[model samples]
Target chain A: MNDKKTTHFGFQEVPVEEKAERVAEVFHSVAAKYDVMNDLMSGGIHRLWKRFTIEASGVRAGHKVLDIAGGTGDLSYQFAKLVGSNGQVVLADINASMLGVGRDRLTDRGIAGNINFAQCDAQFLPFPDNTFDCITIAFGLRNVTDKDMALRSMLRVLKPGGRLLVLEFSKPQSEILSKIYDTYSFKVLPFMGKLVTNDAESYRYLAESIRMHPDQQTLKEMMDTAGFVRTEFHNMTGGIVALHKGIKP
Target chain B: MALFMTSTLTIAALASAEKMLNAALRYDPATRIGLAQLEGKILAVQITAPALQFFIMPMDDELRLMGNWDGDVDTRITGSLLALAQLSQTEIHNLKDSGVTVMGDLSLLADLQRLVKNLDIDWEEMLSQFTGDIVGHQTAQMIRAKFGWAKDRAQSAQRLTSEFLTEELKALPSKPELEDFYRQVDDLRLAVDRAAARVETIINRKNIKEKSNP
Candidate 1:
């Protein structure tokens, strides 16, 4: 008889303690080709989604921002520019491979001085209380082993009145779109992954994990339960992805 | 969400616009340098006819356009699309009658206007990136000559049409003729006023004589 706590790793249930390690392995495998795969898989819609998130962030000069799970420094690069010389942006990721890729990409792009790279988990941020004015996790919250704990940690590090934005895949609103999306995700995505990165299993896990992640309304409730205020969500691409925003009050 | 479609479409449009603008600016290094000076300043453009608002912020040598912005703006211009377009090319003093309203940081608007007026794109250099330098230069020269000839021909045609109408056909008055007509009308108006004053004096004198006889 097994007595250990269990959590969902893709479609399979595993010991809660092992979920992070499994997720890390998946990211490490795909870190180098992550950006390319994202562009190809999403048909470059990911860039538009990320652009929308940046516009919604309300980040300006002289504001500290924390971009958790900021793989390849997409949001962090923009935030560093927005914050200017006086502001700071911390790009934090749990996977060392992803963090290393992000740091190298950002440095190569000549984005430095205001940006910092951190190998830290969202569940236990290493920052002091009330530090960041805004925090964002783009397509990353779904992979978190304990999302509620991560939300709490984010809230703890955010200043009063600061907002957190969560951009992730969610349930589609239309039935037809959902069916088409499922077929594409299960059939086309992994094949492309195999062709490009030679890692079909990781892409399959991505599809399964997206299916297991909470819906838009449920995630809003989770943020509310984590002591956030004024939680709301905006669905993009016909609800294939949603961005949830909550203010720390 | 309705808000989702609006924001998504807006962000996408702004992204494309920014890309095209930066691409054009790449050939105009002077304009790019001028843009760098205005970095971090936000400009809000409110169009009354379409009822749309967007914010423009310059960063480095690029421009970032946003559908929504929360921070304070350095300048805000509210007008119809045509009025705003005219304001960009027209003089600042003419804006009062151009139906454009401007608020905050007048100097910023002046600086932007100056920059826009001074923008000179180097099409030869841009084309050289694709074609060889000699071919690019020859193509650019041909284009310039064609444009100059077309402009000269258009101006000459306009002048000929004006002369044909006013001098030959006599269908419209020339500038000097119109001024002379205006001067004659003014003299006639003064003459009429003088005659009316003389009649009023005679009437007053006749009324006094009648009162004395009574």
Candidate 2:
């Protein structure tokens, strides 16, 4: 009965084709203030989140890594050091503005000779098959129009025994904690966003999008369906954010 | 309502303090570089009483907090919150003697102690960002002089207090008493060694007779 392909964009249903454009606009508007807004909203716990991701990543020297939708290059910067001179890290993002900001920031931090940049969509990574030893999407997977396609794309580029780590906002595990989180995300978050970036709607979208994202179990199942073996998820900050990891066969 | 308000205010202040400390530790050149010895090492500090655990990773001039590191740490330092506070103030010397329990590598404890002793904050470098070089340098020099005078006074006071306790009040063993105790222990050890040698000589003579008879 329902033949039309529609996807939810922050609680609103829209054609799958148009979702990417809408997401692009939101990122383009907030790209400049993304890092600052993250520190403000999360109170710098995002750094700890990324640090945990790195620890679980098992990334070592001389490994090729791909960071999909790597906005502002925080993960990429750490990965560059981890991979060392013998290794390579490609920071890929769909939004040019976000990618440009990431490139400039990383360059300013002297992260060169090992790190590369790419403005590519997650649904269709432009790397060769079996290209990377590890692939990471930190807080970037929720914005993708087709998460399944992106997962498969990541899988395609990953070598056998390679790992895929998906770090994103997820449903809270407790009812009481969920209530507090809802209050903070809806009431306090948008106001803070307005104060910093002067765009309440963008922050509102962030909150809504996080709610709409797949919960931990569902995401683990989805990763399994995408032909990734041994999928697991780690709930952090009372399930406010989850880091899901899967391995390629 | 007042209780709830107080708790909320406390949480906000703690959060602010954590953020500020994170930035300060990251930006301070000496602390950052000094922490490099902790590279690839996960150090966990467990504060009893309040029951808090902080996992620390020291990278190249950066102190990274690995969130809720429940894994095995290279070193774990546990103490009462008061003891840890005393340690930060250098009020407690010798953590093991101060009732602080240390598990895992002892080198980590030594490294941390050395780091605490050598912690020198460059206030002028921090001030130069706001007030430029010359004024910052002058202000820093003045502050350093005052700090030096205070440090001298404190050291002298500590020496006097120690002397009063050990010599005047006889609260602790005096130097001669301690030396005499060490001398008695050494003599006892030598006497034990001589007795052991006599026993060994008897055993060797009996063994020789048994071998000759066989």
Candidate 3:
């Protein structure tokens, strides 16, 4: 925690202020090809990972939900339904391009009345404190410049007894699987990116960022530090993807 | 059980849960969604869109092919994420066989469009044709490199034609030399890049407009 302000854009060290714009550029460049690349590189496993995340979210009717870094609204869409007509799901993200992708996806399903889209940075969510019943950041936290700051903001915005679910890539459970995933991610992923999205660099950054994110235990501790109670992690698929859930006590 | 509204299953809620679970088995499921299956049901991830091409694919044989997942052939396969709800091995299989076709709702279209452009070259080509290129690659590359895209990462790119190239070529000097036109062609390529960027911007904004539609 240096006040001088340093951050990482993928693997490179830099001043924190410029990171958001750079992140935006990568997303904007790849917005259209994002989903196709996900299928090509992950062999559609990302879908299962996301499914696990949704299954863990516990949202229900009349519950106000906040989907931070809700890229393409994978989780927000789920929250919208569980919350039903009386509840509202706000899909927010720093990158307009990513938010645009999510917004369009939700609208096409005949679900416009229950959802809203807002462009916001996670470090400083636009909503007032204690407003949401639940908040989720699915695969969105790794792209943030300040993970701790974003987590704190998330904690601050939750109503008492509200839950926060962090669904993201985590360290693999097995060394053998890690090695295989490493080789596959570092090698085949970039090549697939080149062929599909024509943006090998973005794909490379994604792989790198996954390696850099906090592991399940560390993330759980961070949640605890954010004043959450009953913080626990659910390891999915050998821990490649983990769901960290905590209640706002 | 957890004092978090964990109540015994009712028939009506169970039915609603079944409907939602049926949807999830067909599409993407909501993350951390406990309400979906109080009775072992699951809610599908919702995707809303004007296009629906990306989300709402018909769950036919063609549907399974969209993933192109080459999972093991010998093993009995069920629930590959891309599998239609009817085929899942979960107890919710009965719900899946009911044929609900709405895909999950998407949040930010720009993100999906970005993914689509990266994964679907056809989509990218369509965008590039709609938008003319103008921003110089060298300049754009320089910007990204400054922000730390690896030398290897910065180099990977899609080759797209510029609408400005031909237009600019026509505007060349009356007695322009071959070298001048060659440089102009280079400039045209840059223009095409800009055009592609614009098309993406338009698509993202258009999608947002669609999201707000009734």
DockQ of each: 0.31, 0.04, 0.01
Best by DockQ: 1
What are the runs in model 3 whose C-alpha is more than 4 Å off? A1-4, B1-214
| Whole-model Cα lDDT of every candidate shown, in order | 0.86, 0.79, 0.63
lDDT, residue B61, candidate 2? 59
Q: Whose lDDT is greatest here?
A: 1
lDDT of 3 by residue, A1-249 (tens): 567777888788878888888888888888888888877776776665665455456565688999888888777876776677889999998888888888888898766788989999999988899999889888888889888888889989999988898888899999999999999889998898888888889888889889989999999999888789999887766778887889999
**Candidate 1 DockQ score?**
0.31
Q: Candidate 1: lDDT of B123?
A: 47
True contacts kept of each: 0.58, 0.03, 0.00
DockQ winner between candidates 1 and 3: 1
Candidate 1 on B1-214: residue-level lDDT in tens? 2223345655666676566657777788887788899998989988786466778888887777777776689999999754665465445765657778889998888777766644454646633433457765865676556556867898999999999999999999999999999999999999999999999999999999999998
Poorest 10 consecutive residues of model 1 chain A by lDDT? A48-57
TM-score of chain A of each: 0.99, 0.98, 0.95
Q: Residue A139 in candidate 3 has what lDDT?
A: 84
Q: What is the TM-score of chain B alone in each candidate?
A: 0.53, 0.45, 0.18
Which pairs of residues collide in model 1? none
The clash tally of candidate 3 reads 83
Clashing pairs in model 2? none
lDDT order of candidates, best first? 1, 2, 3
